[model samples]
Every structure is written in C-alpha cells, then in structure tokens.
Target: MSDGFSSFAKLFSGYYSDKLGKRKEIATFGYVATGIFPAIIAISMSWTVVLIGRIFGWMGRGIRGPPLDAILAKSIQEKGFRKAFGMHRAGDTLGAMVGPALAFVLVIRIGIRDIIWLAMIPGISLQ
Candidate 1:
C-alpha cells in the first residue's frame, strides 16, 4: 500500500538532493525521519496516527535511498564498486534479519513500550 510513496520519494528526493547539492543533509534527514515514526507507531493511541506515521517513515526511506546510493558510489573505487554495494546490501539484509529476531526476544521480556524505545537506539544513533 505504501509502495507508491517509496517509489515517488525515490525519484523526487533523488532529484532534490542532486539539485540542492546537500547530499549529506538530505540523506541524514531521510534516515532520521525513518527512525522517528516507528517510535511514534509504538506509542500512538490511535490507528490514524499509526497510519500517518507509517506513511511518513516510508517517505523518509524513499528520500534517503538515492542520496545514500549516490554518495556510496562516489566514495568507492570503480573496480570495487560492486563489492561495496554488495556489502551494503548484505548489511541491510542482516539488519532486517536481526532486527525482528531481537525485537521478538525483547518484546517477550521487556514488553512493547520498552522494546520500542530500545529498538529506537540505532535510529537515534544514525541521526
């Protein structure tokens, strides 16, 4: 359902980042924006709020993706570019795997409120 936002954000945000010459700032904002609303989702008292937060969070990711990719490509050597991107993909996949497993364990022990807060650590660190 939110895939549309991701697609649009990927396109437009990439354009915006390129035009503004603020790759770092835009990328960081996108990443930080993603980090924030999960906590909001965790704490929100209503479904509407959850949905809104979810949309915004996905948008941030869409915005962040292209800038990060551009920066990453620029930072690496041509010969090792594939390797660098492969590593980046692997890290992203690993985080996806680890995050849910960690959350499952933590949710059982610490409860939702606390787990959500604990889950927010890396996002805050990213910001």
Candidate 2:
C-alpha cells in the first residue's frame, strides 16, 4: 500500500526534479519529509496517523532516490562515476544492514518508539 504511493511519487518527483532543475532542493524536501513523518508516528496515538506517516515516509524515500542519483551523476566526472556510485551504493547497503540491527538491539533496551525518535536524528542532519 505504501509502496503504491512511493511508486507514484517517485515517477512524479523525478519528472519535476528534471523539469525544475532543482535536484538539491527536491532532495532536501524528500529528506525532510522522510525524517519528520516517522517522528510524527512516534508521537501519534492512533493507527490512522501511523498509517499516514508510513505512507508519506515511504513516498519521501521514493522522492529522494532519482534526484539524489541525478545529483551524484552530475557531480562526478565520467571517469569516476563507477567508483562514486559504487561508494554511494555501498553506504546505502551498509545503512540497510546496520539500521535494522541497531534498531533490534535498541528496541530491546530503549523501546520501539524511542528507536524511531533516534532514527530521526540522522535524517534531520541530512537537512
């Protein structure tokens, strides 16, 4: 369900990023949305709020990807594209692995809501 929103958002966001030539700003909006929404879920007491937050958060994730790639592609020289993208992908993969593991450990210690709050810290820094 969230994926549907994400998929649609990715298509439109990518189109606008190109049309506006504002990859950085669009990407920043994505990061802010992704960050803030989960924190919204943390404070909310209703399942509907959680559902809304999750859908928007996933859409934020979708919104960032293409513009980020566009920024990376623009910034790097052709000769170093492989290396640069590889490093970017590596960092993403590392985060994917580490985030859940860290959350799993933190959930046992601090609880799930706190973990979600903590997750917002890094995202906030992106802005």
Q: Total backbone clashes of model 2?
A: 0
RMSD of 2: 1.1
Cα lDDT of model 1 by residue, 89-117, tens digit: 99999999998898898888889878767
Among these predictions, the greatest TM-score belongs to 2
- Clash count per candidate: 0, 0
What is the Cα-based lDDT of residue 21 in candidate 1?
A: 83
The TM-score values for the models, in the order shown, are: 0.92, 0.94
Candidate that scores best on lDDT: 2
Runs off by more than 4 Å, candidate 2: none
TM-score of 1: 0.92
The digit string of per-residue lDDT tens for model 2 on 61-86 reads 89998999999999989999999999
Misplaced by over 4 Å in model 1 are none
